[model samples]
Target: MSTTALSKPWTITRLGWLFQPISDRGHEEAMVLSVYRDHGVIPKDSRTDNFNRTPENLSNYQLVQPGDLVVNRMKAWQGSLGISEHQGIVSPDYEVLRPTAPEYDRRFLHSLLRSRALIDQYALRSTGIRPSQWRLYWDEMKTIEISLPAAKQQRAIADYLDRETARIDTLIEEQQRLIEMLRERRQAVIDESFSTLGDPSVQLRRYIKFLTSGSRGWGDYYADQGERFLRIGNLPRANLEIRGDIQFVDLPADVTEGSRTMLQEGDLLFSITAYLGSVAVIKGDWVGAYVSQHVALCRLERDRVDPRFIGWFMLTTTGQDQLNEGAAGGTKMQLALDDIRGLRVPTASIEQQRRIAAHLDRQTAKIDALVAETERFIEYARERRVALITAAVTGQIDLREMA
Candidate 1:
């Protein structure tokens, strides 16, 4: 048979028709299900098992049956649509669909709709000012065109994807475990090096010229391109490097007070709230960046203390223990400026500190390289998985030939 024999263009509505919107008006005693963005439908009870509080009235909920297609309308553009495997009632905000013809493979359609290409189609059809608020209504979703294959071909493709993706997922999991081990090893090295210093301890206040947080009300100065604005979210958990999701703001002449929070190369930063004790060092790239109020800037006495060594010390168990003991507040832990000032830090001679920092910098670079390579491999594996699913469901690749 020709490779393209099974390919046929079909609109989404033609493949599986929408289920008549049914409400539990008369049936108030139904199980409530919630549709997760990427994950499939899950009963609300399961999510709130600890609270054990079911809604007093589920009469407004919509009923869903096995094999029905469920889409969280608000998040449909994010690949939130999936075939329901459970018989329950979902929120009225969700859309439900059922296959119109017996020949349609539900699993194949699920894979097709969740593919990256189709998800982008969903984004195109969605309407909203921002991505977070985008909504894919039924009118747009119904008109989406998809390539269909014969029922047997569809089933075969789904089965092939299921088997292949499982193997890829296993490998990804193994790589994730290896990355975790590498992190632990890096941490152990940092802890050992710091513990063996056998040097005098000094209050952090003595070594630092200034310890202060950023001023508020700078939101008005936020700009797409300007000086980088660092926040608690930008701080890495273990590494001394600052990275990811950095925002920027124009350095307006009137906002001169922000200069105090502006970072210098080799300066140390500590997260004061939420993820307390998370530390990072200001690199050359972030030299002029300003930090948020949630972050504490420590301008070190470079002549006496090495910033890198201080940053690494915070990641060690001893340093964390001291920070943890002084940490205040429940649920949302915070480190007060005074508490941070009082915390004792180990101090070796400047030369020894520089040597230790240099050694760690080299060791961590090696570990970071390995972790980055494994992360790239995982990304490729995920991309391959998505491509395989898209090709199979769209009949871009013939399963019979692969078989």
Candidate 2:
């Protein structure tokens, strides 16, 4: 197959001739199915990460038979459609299409419709105010033009992709497992080091110059472009520094000084609600970020104790237990300002603390670099898999040569 051109004569036809929209009801007793961008169509119960839960009332769900095409119109542009292998029911919001022509292979339809080329088409034809809101209904999808080979060639192409993609997927899974192992090792190193790193310890209150909790009802100050607004999600889970997407807020100058939530360098931030035990040490770029009420801003006596050391200590098994000891208020996990002030931390000599932190810095960096490189490899492997599928289904590859 040539990357730039097809190998054989292909019929360019509208998808309207290939599929007919179907919405058979009264299959509420059947298994529930969902479409995922990466995994395609599978039983909803099989995935633990699905955000949409099954509603108690299944009377409105649409029936899906084997070989039926299911498309999540909201995410069609992201390739969230697949040919179902099970007789199940899906959300009424989803579109189910049954093949009307015998010339097309079921597996080919699954691969072709989910290809990167077709995803771009879905995105182009969708209607919405913004990209996030774009929706591609069947009315628009049916009108899209597609190229297909004869039924025999379609089956051959599908067979080739099935084998190739499986190999690539297996390799990616191996790398993913390795990344998980490295993370476990990283945590182990931190815990073991903290054990003998310090002998003399003191209450965290002793080193605290000032402690304050973030304010509530600052939603009005949120903006697309302004100073960073730190939320609980931004607090690092295993590491000492803040990470992930940052939210910006245009704070009013009049109330900035009184808020006391504007963080400074060397400040320690703790997640006081929801996901407790998460902590972060503020650095240069995060200096002016305003913390949300869900997080507590602890302006410690930085000169007395290294904020990074304290931050790293909080992530250890011993530190996590202490942090969660006072996580109480209601059904939801929570922590009050008092809970943080009275907490105990491993306070070693400044030189000893820096040594421990430096040792961890070197160890974790090596592991982190390997993880990042492996992750990039998997990403590129996925892109190649998609390109192969796109090539096969679009008749760019000579099926006879593959055989």
Location of the lowest summed lDDT over 10 successive residues in candidate 2: 1-10
RMSD of each candidate? 3.7, 2.5
Off by over 4 Å in 1: 1-20, 25-32, 43-59, 198-201, 223-228, 245-256, 330-332, 401-403
Q: What TM-score quantifies how close candidate 2 is to the native fold?
A: 0.91
Estimate, for each residue in 1-403, the C-alpha lDDT of model 1 and write its tens digit. Answer: 3445343443434332533333433456666777765457777666643353556777777778777778888888878878777888876678877655646677787788788888898899899999999998877777777776666777887788889888989998999999999989988988888877764378889998888988887788789999999988999887788878878899767658888888998888988886776899998779999889999898889999898988888888888777787775566578888887887888788999999989998988899899999999989988888887776777776567543
- Tens digits of lDDT, candidate 2, 244-360: 897888877777542588888888889998688999888889887788889988888766788888888888888888888788656878988888887888768888888887888
Output the number of the TM-score-best candidate.
Answer: 2
TM-score of 1: 0.85
* Residue pairs with clashing backbones, model 2: none
**Model 1, CA-based lDDT:** 0.79
Q: lDDT of all the models against the reference? A: 0.79, 0.85
Q: Which residue window of length 10 is worst by lDDT in model 1?
A: 14-23
